[model samples]
Target: MTIKSHSSRESRNPRDFNDPRNKPQERSERPERPERSEWASRRSDRPEGATRERTERSRPDWAVRTEQRRSPRERFEGGDRPRPPRGAGLLAELRELDRDLIKMIARRSRMLTRLPASGASDHERELRTSWEEHASAVSRDPKLIRQIFALLQEVEVAPADMEQPTAFNLAPMRKPVNVDLPAPASDRLPRVHMTLAASGASECVLHGVPLNNPVMECLKGLNQVGARLRWEEDGRILCQGGEPVSGYSKSILDKVVHVGDDPFNLFLILFQMVTRPARLKIIGESGLKFVDLAPLRHFLPLLGARLTSVVPGQEGLPARLESSAMLPSEVAVPADLPADAVEALLIAAAGWERPVTMALGEHPEGRSVASKMLPILRDAGIEATLTDAEGALSLHVVPGKAHFGVEPGTGINLSAAAALLALPALAGGSVKLRGAWDATGDDQTREGVRELFAAVGLDMRFSADCAAVSFGEGLGEDAELPPLKPLTDLSGLPSSLFPVGLVLALIPAVRAKGGDLPRLPQNTDMTLVESFLNQLGLSCEDGRLVSIAPASTPWASPSFPWALALSLAAFLRPNIKLVNPGIVTNHLPWYWNAYNSLPTPSLARKSAEEEAAPAPSRPARRRVLASHTPESEMPDEIVYPDED
Candidate 1:
C-alpha cells in the first residue's frame, strides 16, 4: 500500500478510455472499482453454477441491444429498426390507378340506374348532364387514364355515342330513301253492296270491298233466291222487294264485295239480312261470320227464303225465295213486327178490322223480339200462335178456347202478341183472359210497353203483386173517366196478366168510358217516364227509385210524331191511352220556348278571357336554350337541330 499507485484510467479498457491521438485527453487519478463478475459473485448467496447462469440467461443480449438502433419510422414508433426506402414513382402510379378505377366504378354504377333520354324524367335528365360533365373531367385527368380503360371493360358504350366507321371515303346519309313503286290507294279495289230486308218493310244495306282478308271467306254458302238488287253509282246496292236473283249469276258477282273500314258493321247488317232474307248470295268479298250463320238455319224458311244444301266440296249454297200467288195486300201482315213496321202495314191495310184484341206475356231471356201479341179472333175459338218472321212476329189468331196463361218458355214476342190481343178489348169489345198475368219486373223494356199504353189514355192499374184492367164499356167520345194514378206492385203475377191488364184498361179509356189512370210519355220506356219527370222540372237522385211531387195538372199530352203514335198503336193497340188535351196544351205555351232555344256561351267566353291574360312578373333569369352548337357558335356534328 505504500507503493506508488498507477492511474485508474491506465487500468481501464482502451475502448472505454478517451483517445489521446485524436484530441488532448484529460486524466484523473482515482481508485479502481472491483470487477463486475467479482461484485456479482460477492452479492449473491446462490451456487455459482446454476443461479448465476440462470441470471445471466434472463438478461437481454447484444443482439436485442443492437435492435434498439431503429431507422426514422421505427424510432418514432419505439420499435425495431426499419429497412431502407424503395422508389416512390411506381407506388404513386399504382395508387392513382386504384383511385381512378374506384371513380370509374362509381360512374358506371350511376349510369346503370339512369334511364334513356326518351324515357328520362326531369330529375334523370339533370343527373345525366352532371354524369357527362364528370366523365369528361375524368377523361382529361392523366392519372385516371388507366382506370378509365379498365372501367370501359365493365360499361357498354351506347351505340348512339359511337362513331360509325367506313372502309373508304364515304358520303353522308341522304335525306330520303329511293323507292321505285308508288304507294297503294285505299279505294282502288272493287266494292259490292248487299241489301237485307228487315221485317218485310225496311232494308239494311251493307257495303263490301275486296280486301281479300281471311274474314271474307264467310260469304260462301248464301242463297240468292228472290232479291232484286242493282248497284248504284256510289257503290251502294238498291235491293227492292221482288223476285230472287239466281245463285249462279256470276263468279265475280257471286263473290261479295268488301265494305270500307268498318267490317264489323257490315257483318252485323249481313247477319240480320241473311237470317230472314228471301234470297241471299255473296256478290263479293263482304266480311261475314260463318259460325254465327249456322244457328239461323231454321229461320230462313219462315222468312220466305229457301236455303239449299251444298255438296261436301262446294263452297256456297244457292238460296231461293218461295213464290206464292198472294199479293202483299192479300198476305196478312204479322202483328209482331217492330212498332214502326207494324204501323206501316196497318196504315197500308186501311180496311183492317177496327178493334183487334190481343194477349201479351213476358219475353223470355234469349228471345230476339222485344215483345209479342197474340190475336183473339172473335168467331173462331182457336188460340193464337205467334212466330217471328223477319223483324215481325206473325200472329196466327184463330178463334178457339182462350189460352191466356204464360208458359215458362214464353218470350217478348209472345208478350207483344198478347198485348195486341188485349188492345181490341180496350177499344170496345168483350174479351176474357184466363190466368194471372203481370209485366212488372226489372225489365226496362216492359216498362216501355206499359208506357205506350198509358200515353193513349188507358185505365191501367198495378199492385205490388198484380196488374188489373176493367173494360166497363169502351174508349169513345161519349165516355168519361176520373184522372189516372201511379200503380205500385205487380210481382208474383202470371205473365199473361200483362196483356189482360192492357186490354181491360184500353177498352174503357179508348172508349172514353170514365176512370182515373196513369199518364205516360210517347217514347214508352222507364227512361221516358224518368225523362217526363225531368222535363217537368223534377230531379232523380237514384236510378230506379224516383221521387216526384203530385202533378199540378191531371195528365200531359205526349209530344211525338204521328209515325211514333202509329207504331204505338200497332204494337200496343187499343190498350194504348192518351193524356187529357187540356194539361198538355196548357204546358206547351209556357215550356216550348225554352226547349227551342240554343244554350248561351257567356261563361265559356269569360273562362277564355281569363286564360288569355298575361302572367305576373317575377325575378329576371338567364334564358338557356338547348345545346345545338359548339364553342365556335357553329352547329356541332352531333348536335340535334330540332332540339333547340
Candidate 2:
C-alpha cells in the first residue's frame, strides 16, 4: 500500500538480508582454516594443557636443534675434524733440538781425536778448556736431560748395525824366544854403561841400543843437551829429570840410529826411568868413544842452562860441563813417535824450558848428528837456530825469547823425518833454506817439502833448486828459530837420505797443486806409506808409482778412517801405480801381499777386419725439385728412403 512514498525503504525489510552489497565477502586478508580430518580438528579443539603436551611431543627440543644444526661456512671449515693433542708441535721441535745437540758433541769428539801430539798453545789450551766447560754444561742442561731419555728410547726402537765379528775361536800362536841370536864375536867392542836423568825416563836406558855409529853420535848430542845421564854398571845407564828436548834437533837425533828403526822402542826404556838425579855424570871405559859432545853446545841453552867449555889452557877441544837447573814450571813432552831411534830421544826431550842446542859445522860430526836430531827437536817444541856461519842449530833456552834465524840457501836434510820434524817448527817460525835436494838430486823432494809446508798452513817458498822459510812471530815465544830437518833414511850421506821423507811428506802438497816430486828410490821401504794409506782407509798396489781411477768412493771402514777422503786417494795412489813407503819396516806383513796383488792381462788373438774397420764408402745423392706436389699429382715418388 502507499508504494509510491516508501519506495526505497520498502526494499530494506527483513527479507532483504541477502542483499548483494551487504552479503559477507570471501576473506581476502584473514587466513583460511586448513582442511583437516575430523581427528585433527578435534585435536586442535583440545584443552590448553593437553594441546601444549601434544605440541611438546611433536616438536623437537631447542637444545637438540641447536646441537644438530651448523652454519654452511662452519661445516665447510671442518668444524667436525679432529685436532692434534696439545703441545705436539713443541715436542717435535724439542726432538730436532736434541738431535742437533748430539751431533755437536760427536763433532767435538772427532776434533779431539785429531789433536796434535805436541802440547797445545796457550790459545789452543784456553779454547779446549772452554770447549770442555761448554760440553759439561750441555750435558747438564735440563732439555738435554730430557733429550737423553728420548734418545735412549729411539735407540731402543732402532738399533745400529754393527758389522764387527763377535765370536773368536782362533788359536793363539806360541813362538820361541831368542830364535835368532847373533854369535858373540871376540873382536866386538865392550858394552859401556851410561846413566841419564830427566823428567821422563828417556834418559835412563836405550833399548835395542844401536852399535856406536854416526847415528848414535847424533843421538848422544841430543841426550847430552836434554837430560842428565851417567854411566852405571856395564852396559847400563842411569837418568834423571831434565829439560824436554826440541823437535828442531830431530835430524841429529835420527842420525843416532839406522833408518826404518822404531825410535819409540829405543826410547821407551829411557821414558820409563823415574829417578831424578841432582848431579849425574858418566864414568865408563868407552863412555867417550861413541860420545860426541858437540850437540851439548846447542842442548844446554835450551834447558835454561849454559855449557861452559873448561879449557885447560886450551890444549885441544875443551872439556864441557853441560848442566842446568830445572825451573818450577813443567814442560810438555810431545807424544809423536820419532821417525828413527835418534829422533825419538830428541823428540822426547824437546819440551824443556832450556832445550839443548847443537852447532852444526863446528865438530866434524855435528852436521851428521844435527840431521838425525832435527826431526825429534822440531817435534819436541824446541827452537833450533841454525847459525849461518857454523851450520849449527842452537837449542835456545830462552823459550819466550828464542828466535830461529836461517840463511837463504841453507843445505839442510829434508827427509820425511826431517820434514815432519821441521813442519812444527817451520809452521811457527821464519826460515831461509838453500841447496835442498833429494838423495837422488831431484827437485821433487824439495817441492814436496814446500807442499807440506803449505798443507800445514806454514809460510814457505821453494824454487827449482832452492827454498826459503820464515817463522811467524806467533809461533810460540822463540818463533824466530830455525827448525830441525831429520833424516828419514841414513843408508848413505845426508845428500842421499834427506829427500826421502821430504818427498813423501810433500805428496799431498804436490797433489794440491803445490808442486811435484821425483820418483823415489826403488829399494826405499814403503811401510810408512802403507801405514798412512791404512790410516786413510785405502790400500796400495803396484810399486811406489801408480795412478788412481776417479770414481772410487766406497764407504771406508772405521778401522781405516781418514780425515780427508781425497787426501787418502791422492797420497795412497800418489801418481798411478807409484807407491812409496818412506823408510820401510821388516815387520810390515802387508808388503808381500800388496806386491803380489798387482793386475795382469790375458793374451788373446784379434781379427784383422775388426782391427782395421776405419774406412767406408759414401753414398751419392741426386738433387730433387723443391715443389709441394700432392701424391695424386706426382707421377712417381719414393715415400721412404733406405738407409745404406
Most TM-score-accurate candidate:
2
Candidate 2: list runs displaced more than 4 Å. Answer: 1-349, 353-356, 363-381, 390-587, 599-644
Best by lDDT: 2
Cα lDDT tens digits for candidate 2, 264-374:
332322221111112222221122212233443444344444433332111112233323334323222222212232333333333344444432333443444445444
lDDT of 1 at 429: 25
What is candidate 1's lDDT per residue for 1-644, written digit by digit as tens? 55555763345455754655444435554457799998887767566587656755776887456545645555545334465568677788899999997787667665755656575446434644454567767577633442333334235543556785422111211111111111111111111122212112223333432222211322222123234444444334343534322212221223333332233323332333332222334222211211222322443344334434221211222222231112221233233323323322222122122222221222232132223222212111234345565634344333222221321111122232233323322233222222223422124444644553464445445444334333434344334333333332223223323323423333333333223333322233555444433322243344232334423332232331211222223222222223432222231221112111211101122467677765567455679889665678765566657864
Candidates in order have lDDT scores of: 0.33, 0.35
TM-score, cand. 1 vs. native = 0.20
Q: Model 1 segments beyond 4 Å from truth?
A: 1-226, 229-481, 489-530, 543-644
